[model samples]
Target: MTVLHEKLRGKDTGYWIIQCTNPLTHKRTTIRRNPKTDAKFKTKRSAQEFELQFLKSSMDLNMKFSGLFEDYCNYLEVHKSGKSLIDMKSRYNRFFVHLKNKKIVNIRESDMNLIVRDMQSNGYHSSYINTIITTMKILMNFAVKKGYINNNPIANYPKLKVAKTNDDLKFWTPEQMKQVIESIPEVYKTAPDVRQIQHIIRFGYFTGMRYGEIRALRWKDIDFNNNIININNHISKHNTERAGRKNGDYHQLVMDDDTRAVLTEIYENHKKQPEFTNDCYVFHSATRGPYFPLAATTGNKYMMKLAEANGLKHITFHGLRHSHASYLISIVGLSEAEVADRLGDTVAVTSKTYAKFFNQARVRAANKISSHKLGF
Candidate 1:
């Protein structure tokens, strides 16, 4: 801390001078502060405090966007790091290379507008570009909290409106799911990789389990007596074992008759193998033995290949979860809250995602009420 003692308004006062070096440009910066407004100039602690606070808010004036972003990424690494951290670094470096050297305070709306227009012109999906923009907003929000900037510039920009397509509704019915499952030739089932895909897809459809949860599931998680699959952890996209789920909920899916049957079938078959262990992955990796989890991408590619070739709609592994949710809402007539609980999601998300199914449920209720005999 550099303190300057000088005459201010005919009174001798101690002032704080902050020196911030921009890491990106390697340029030296000097910022002087008068402690008269918020701090008593006599105390040394006030000058120190003034220096600290000035670094935060006026930082935007001193540091470039990339330098602040690196600091923000470091902050996130300690607080909330994930596969997304890696993705953000790559994304920003590629697209917003120009923003790297510009001071955080100078990053304006017009600069963002040009980036969006370029991305749109390049055939990038609105949803994908929206995700990129969201990361920027989150970073800018961090800057605001740290006093890097007074307000987030990107916050005011509207997300590119995504057009809804049938591609968005990429789920299958019970019959469709069954057809795709059976479409795997009986001969291919002899291969461990093919069998693993066959079973995992079926599991995803019936249980509404995320690919992460399914890959992370251990043989120990199956409670035969209680008929529940304890979804204790999620394997992140980076293939790391996250202790809790995405929503931070410890979920246990009570197995339906179909789910229980599927679980039992896998256990009965898997128990016979020498590789089987109590703590082994329920959906064990075909290539990596019982210790490692099955790869989601490999399963998706092979599963889609067989299904698409046989005139079945392509339902990727994640689509199986959606298919299950659609089934619960439409076939079983489960409430939004009930579906959300079963799927380890919030009711609001369930309602929004399966809106058409809920609308159909409303129609069914209307028909039932009109046919009722009880009247005044």
Candidate 2:
């Protein structure tokens, strides 16, 4: 192996010579009278120590903020599961664009605070701000671990406070649900676009599956004998592309008789169409290759029309999932934990958000007890 040495000069005319070998080329290089020489040592032991410290600092300085961010995104793609990689990529890309010119070490708590405050001031919700902050923190932490920075600026940053809204907990009553179901046009059951929409609605109510999970459903994931639908994958739209159709990456959800019957009907209908055979999606758009899970705005518009036609108040499609959970807990008498498991929600979230429905159910139960005791 070849070694190289050179002397570097200090601002005050002081200089030190440093020696090191290039690992890749196995070539030796030495620097003499370097600016950092004044802090040098006379003994070989002291020289070795000084060289090690200088090399460590040099390596740290060589780590670029942009490089760290790229590695962080790659880490997310490889290590993070459940969320679509496309979605993660989009979010990270937006964050990177915003932070492109900023140095990782220069990012401070005040900078984050200002960015968060600006977002909030511009009418962005706390949830959205939280997601941005989360992405930023992930990258910053990665930089710290890579020796690019000594500390993570986001470590002590205040979290955005998400305000609860009635929409967040909205659910349809049984009468309202029945009205909407009855009002759906009979032709929708047969028409390709409407059929998919009908099936999506029914599945959401019966299985509490999200829009993405419902769209990603394939014939293979369904186990009719076991009455279960595996939710191992989700269909998400990011960068105008549909993703979430792969293997061993989806979750499983139980299918009740109602949901099974609806799915079976759709499947049978699809099989009759020569073009839309078993190979096609269970719920697909006629125009679009397969339904990309309608955007939130479009889905809301359809939901509003459905509600109005049924003589019911407007409710979003997600309200169907909430209604399913509410019905299970209140009318069906399922425990909170059971409701959580069926809805793919954490027990704590289920209990906190849906506990009010249980309170009402308990009151009704008490009324029944009193009426029975009053025996006229």
lDDT of all the models against the reference? 0.76, 0.65
Candidate 2 lDDT over 230-309, as tens digits, reads 77566553413244423224456777789989988877876676665334656565566532334534456667878777
For every model shown, what is its TM-score relative to the native structure? Answer: 0.61, 0.54
Clashes of 1: 2
Against the true structure, candidate 2 reaches a TM-score of 0.54
Task: State which candidate has the highest TM-score.
Answer: 1
Native-to-model Cα distance after best TM-score fit, residue 196 in candidate 2, in Å: 2.5
lDDT (0-100) at residue 38 of candidate 2? 43
Report residue 306 deviation for candidate 2 (angstroms).
3.6
C-alpha lDDT (0 to 100) for residue 360 of candidate 1? 85
In candidate 2, residue 7 scores what lDDT?
35
What local lDDT does model 2 show for residue 291? 28
Residue 66 lDDT, candidate 2, scale 0-100: 56
